[model samples]
Target chain A: MEEWTVKVEQSDNKKEKPDTEQLEFGRSFTDHMFVMDYSEPVGWHDARIVPYQPLTIEPSAMAFHYGQSVFEGMKAYHAQNGDIQLFRPDKNLARLNHSNDRLCIPPIDEEFVLKAIKQLVYMDKEWIPKAEGTSLYIRPFIISTEPYLGVAPSHHYKLIVILSPVGAYYKEGINPVKIAVENHYVRAVKGGTGEAKTGGNYASSLKAQEVVGKQGYSQVLWLDGVEKKYIEEVGSMNVFFKINGEVVTPALNGSILSGITRDSVIEMLKYWDIPVSERRISMEELYQAYLDGQLEEAFGTGTAAVISPIGELAWEGKKIHVNEGEIGNVAKRLYDTMSGIQYGKVEDPFGWIVKVKEAAPVK
Target chain B: MEEWTVKVEQSDNKKEKPDTEQLEFGRSFTDHMFVMDYSEPVGWHDARIVPYQPLTIEPSAMAFHYGQSVFEGMKAYHAQNGDIQLFRPDKNLARLNHSNDRLCIPPIDEEFVLKAIKQLVYMDKEWIPKAEGTSLYIRPFIISTEPYLGVAPSHHYKLIVILSPVGAYYKEGINPVKIAVENHYVRAVKGGTGEAKTGGNYASSLKAQEVVGKQGYSQVLWLDGVEKKYIEEVGSMNVFFKINGEVVTPALNGSILSGITRDSVIEMLKYWDIPVSERRISMEELYQAYLDGQLEEAFGTGTAAVISPIGELAWEGKKIHVNEGEIGNVAKRLYDTMSGIQYGKVEDPFGWIVKVKEAAPVK
Candidate 1:
């Protein structure tokens, strides 16, 4: 006898035409989802495809009391071959486990989650829109659901994979964005959860987002917590700037999230033979260089927005316009090349694509 | 017509009394609990006393995905008048709302939660063991249950209050505990969720706890993230040290949590005519003072353990014994007075007690 059993959920058989135009990024999810449970007695069990519904758990589950949770976001692009494909999901799975170890949540079999994602994507593949820059965004998460609220590791956890149909990241179509250079309020600090793909880092960014949004900025350009001088990632994305025709970004400082899109840009830039450097780039350096006409382009990279070319940076009530308020040559090339590989328009030399099978409507 | 509705669950006839000595800290819950739900159509509704049972939620709830949750802990003590009383619940309510504003969860009416907690305590009054240094612990938590894996705030949330009979915090009773002075890893940081009673800060401390737990310490004596020089807080408590016979604590830096018990100690000490001060005390200064025999005693204060003294501090292969490895005079006086007030053995001068009416046992 097995330790756990899958109680498969019967779908409601409600298939409406998905309206791609009126969609906010993460508000609309696909119909079906995948789930698995982890226990001390049983590592991972009850893997199943289920109709998307609310779950039943104890009120004192560790997730609510202790925040023993981790998550990852990746997009399933509607390829030219009429199939949705995931971009390097294994990287996400590996990072998820890394965060799990940090929170002391049980480790997940990386390959199993990949297999489950494949199944769920096939089940709700219609949710994948075909318009340019549109894709089915996938969210994979693990949470400790143990009932006890002790200040220690939980014994039980749940892992779930959900899909959402999303429109173009730059919904108004690739226009340059303004960012606020935040001197205070570090999103993640050294020796903290900065490197983990956990909820706290995102939660830490909400206040900064509200502040920057009120100032008409797209996001907050985080600075190092120690000195508040060195450049870091934006609220939810990695930042890059074009200096002297060379691509430069803040190196992996153990205090910034390792973005998948950040890695992709570096790879494509190297493939194009463009000079790329990752080092401790400072805010003063970028601002001063922009004043001296050395800073050509600046953009942010993340799962939501592939590459958002920054138009202006608001600092201490002064706006620093980049490239005369226009998208530079480097931002466009990086965005187009990365999106091409993701959408199957260009050859995937790194073989990042994971083919999603066809959708099967419920009976 | 009301802000919240009640779910009145009467206690069962069969109530088994557990051995008070064997009761674990947070594992045993009482018979009844209070809960309220939040939705867009209805702001906050369905508040009531419900049977202590497992809760049902969506696996993709915002609390699980983005850590959009907050919790408060307090104890209900049974007094000599056969009446149950609660400590400064108003403070918990205000702090909860402050946390709610940051997480974007709607704040339920404070009166409703107060009444709900009263009803829960009345129903499960028997679970309040008469043993010394023990009481019925109440955990009030709010979690965003929106059934989607988005990083943004949740539209749906649930506020829940549960009662659990907890044993003595210290096994041998009031004995000083050993701690590790952490030079790395931060509990809270500037402009982060440290000041808010958020789960993210607790989650960030999980790995630190694990690493320090291996080094033969109960908790980490955390330092400031930016500098790792100033003392911040202990695992789940606020630190107070006696320097040259003066009670000193870390100031309300934007980093340390505003603990209710920490406030109570400050007020009580001031009332007792003790030289109380809330200032930024550094670890280096603390160690130097300890060496000079000016550091009389150090104690941690919180809702769980009213006051626990510290015997030793280990850091970077240096082990420093505090107050000659014993509970010092200052720690004893504060712990005795606070515990006396909490247990209703002393005069209630500050009007901190909110008495509860006990329910008759089921026939």
Candidate 2:
């Protein structure tokens, strides 16, 4: 690996890390940050990990209006032996570039970003939450900053990595979340930036999410745009269901994001001798299986909450309870196994863990 | 309308407005800008028109990532007898607020925004091109500036209005453009941010536009996400076509922007005693109309370019040429009439033109 010097500006106020329970999702931050800029004339340059501070950017930055920004969400976990570990960060690096490509921003070498992130994590190791379900969340993003006022791709960009110490995702306990079937709105489409974790997809989803929030639903299950018939995803997570005792998730359609945790759950479920298949599992099929007593589980997977089981699915003026509002058997098994491996409580079999080294004194 | 404290800053090194024919789109700016900031606790404040300078923004601003931004594009034309005029700027202000409401950003008082824009345009009256086919382009935008990394709305926003002296949109000539019917890529889906003039909708359309450019096409004729059959608007312009002496365009679907120029053209066509209808236009239906030789004219409407006629349509493994690669009659008439009203050369029958006031010293 190419080693880069991390020029640090230590904060004058040496505040200790707060208790894990007191941490908010995105409010608290790690000490240091990583940043690199890309210009048409000059490629990516000025790689640094400095004290986290407000960025002095121009107001006309293209990302502000054109939405020419892409980001990845991944976490570092606290292990039993006081070590920090990352789960398949390579996947996130690849996805970031893929998003950059989709958004027309200049691409960055994935390895370079990964190195920058690993350095920040190591320097801010003390900020990592030590509780059972807490970890330091790392956000890697690239934004266009070209000052020109046009609708074309920006010639300049900024690649930044920031870390925040987040509490357990579901603050109120692991109660199953209820999802409303969104027939009126759609999140992504073929040849769209949906598969790429760009900000536009999330922004476009806010209105529908707001409407569902008023109805007491936790999240939304988006349908296909044209027909409004096919199943897509659960807002920020990839959805899955167990029908006829077999695991099922919507396939890698161009519109849905290929989530990292979604992939891991499938692998873990298969490792435990459970059947798994990636296909276009329709809502009609899930509803039919639920009616026939064949549907045993329904859940969603993403980086924040590893695997969240759905307690109820409401659609078209009707509500359908799944698994009688109890956590499904497969949901629990997959969540435990994945969490165990991530937190270093289980035996390392597939070797998905990558350890971070302590910050060395100026290399 | 509430009067704002205008803080005018004069620039000593102002460049002379380039020759009307030599002006390039979005490459030149005027001497001043209008700006206001919004905070959650305090309403909008410090509304002023200052000298054009690099804006100071926080690096972690939400507009750099979540696409929490929206904008309006209009033009100030230098009419005959040296009177500066704006065409339906009130409509742009209304649309900008609509976009803000969708993105969950605080709405700008339309009258305040209009006054700010009027002050800036009037201050830079010399920048409005005097040539026949050129004008001063106005860009009014708002972006989230809160330096936080959260998924929800931002607490701080900057509302800004900037001006640019722009030449003709189609540099090659007033010739018709060739567009490709994109079968795979989807720009905006049903229930998406297509109707809003937000940054994310434009950002989502860039990749497909890139592909269209690579394939030597001027724009992408987007289709519905699910069926991939219904025709949406062109990348930034609303599309219209003449079939058997009747003008038709896509209806105001939730997934498409209701363009200002398009609305004006519909009104003008009706005023000229020509039939016009806004309805859902399908790709198959358009193709059939072209094959039957009933498609007499094809054009796109937007603020940047009043009406750009379409020469050829490439879809279904074929190229459907319109009227032997020449500008259509309706498109030319619509363009001429609109420009005439804007430039004060025609009778002001519709009363659509609004005159801007001369600048005054700030109190």
Candidate 3:
């Protein structure tokens, strides 16, 4: 793999880090960021870590007008032994490339990017809060920088990575959330951008999400865009259901995002010899299971919340309180185990963690 | 409606206007651009026309990360009699607000926005090319400026309008082009952001477009996301067909943009007492019409390419030559009438043209 040359420029005045206990998601940022530029003929070049600051882009840049942008969400954790680690960093980079392919953006060398990310994370190691459930949130994104307005793939692009100190997703840890079954708005469809980690998928979900939020729901449980029957995803996270001690999740239908956490959960369930199946679970079938008292637990998995337990599902004004509006046993166990491995407190049977290291000796 | 307070800062250095004959679309901007900002509590304010330059946005701005951006495309014509005019500016603003609503961005007052656009266009009237089939392209866009990574409605937004000198959309005059029916990629679904003029819809079409471009097609004719049978809009324009002496275009099924030019064409057809139907026309049905020798003409409508005559369609490796690969009478007539009215060469039967007035004598 071609290595990206790392050039570091430290910030003269670093902002004081926020209180870890009061840290909100994506609000406060670290002192520096990483960026790489791509143009036709020459692929990604000039990879460097510089002071985190506003970027100047032409108003006619393709990213602003065409939405040719993709991003990945992951975190860097301060492990128990003073070692900074990343949970499935390779997976995140792979997914980012998946989105880049779908968006027609140029791909980056995974190994080189991994090294850059590790070096950047190490440079801002102090930003990783030591508090429980707190970590330095890493956002690696690419936007088309070409200033042409025609609706074609851009000839120039910029890949950027910024770090933010984020607290726990939920202030009250492990609490359940209410999700409204989305029927009026569709997030994505087969042969659509649903599977890619692109900004359009998230932009398309804002309306339904806003409506559900106004209706006193925390998130919208999206169904298949075609049939509007089978479950797809929960907001930005992949969903799973434990019905009568058997776990079932909506299979990867090319319209659902392939989440890293979802894959980990499936692997962990199989490792534990738990009955887990990856197949289509229709909303009607799930409701029937709930009526039969077979539905045990439901949760969403992502890098942000890790595991967001679905307490209540509102469908057509009919509500079903999952596990009597409490966090299910499977949800708690999965969260504990996943996060435990992430924070380096538990055994890593799958070897998902990657320790951060200095890319080169400091000058 | 609140009137926007226009503050003007003239550019110290103005770029030389490109030759009208060789002017490319959206590549060269005029001297000044308009901008407005919006916050949660304080709505849109400080409307100003400043020098056209790059905009600096935070790396974590929601628009860059999650694609919370919407835009509208229109044009300002340089009339023969030293006058500049906009065709249906109100319609564009109304549609812009519609996109804003769908994307969860705060809505703008249509009347006020139209006024702002008129003032900006009037200030940059010298950029409007006077040569045949050339004009100043007006791009009005809104982007989420809130520096956060969460996927929801943004608390801050920026509304901007920029002008670019553009020549004819088709360099070879009003010639016909071929289209490939897209089945591998779907642009929009029933409950998706298809109807809105958002960036995501355009972004999602780039990959398919790139493939078809290599296949020697000018555009991709998208089908419905669910069945992939019924015709949707072209990625850039809305489509229309003449079958059995009647004009038919896809109905506003929430998955196709309600194009202003498409609306104008419908109204023009109605005014001429021509049979025009807004209904679903399946690809199979269109192919059957072609087989029966009843399919007379096919064309696309949009502001950029006012009328794009589709000369041929390639479906499943079978090609159907349309109108003997020539511009049909209906398409020629529509393009002539639309551009004629736009350039002040024909009578404006409807009050669609908004003549630009000088903006309070620039200081």
Using TM-score, give the best candidate's number.
3
- Quote model 1's TM-score: 0.94
Q: Candidate 2 vs candidate 3: which has greater lDDT?
A: 3
Give the TM-score comparing model 3 with the true structure, all chains together: 0.98
Clashes of each: 9, 2, 0
User: CA lDDT, every prediction?
Assistant: 0.82, 0.83, 0.91
Q: In candidate 3, how many Å is residue B175 off?
A: 1.9
In the range B289-355, model 3's lDDT, one tens digit per residue, is: 9999998999999999999989999998778778898988888989989899999998889888989
Better of 1 and 2 by lDDT: 2
DockQ values of all predictions: 0.63, 0.64, 0.88
Candidates 2 and 3: which is better by DockQ? 3
CA RMSD (A), model 3: 1.6
**Best model number under lDDT:** 3
lDDT of 2 by residue, A140-254 (tens): 8888887766888989888888888988876776789889999877787777778988888887887788889999998999886656777889968999998888999888888
User: Could you give candidate 2's per-residue lDDT for residues B245-303 as a string of tens digits?
Assistant: 99999888788898999899999989888999988778888889988999999988988
Q: Report the lDDT tens digits of candidate 1 across residue range B1-363.
A: 154456686767435767899988788788778888888877887777777878877656677778888888888987766778888988999888988877667776787688778877877888998887788989999988887655666788888898888887766767788899887777878877788888888888988898889978999999998889899898889999988979999999888889998998899888888899988888889888877888888889988888888988886777778788788886787777777777888778998988987534211
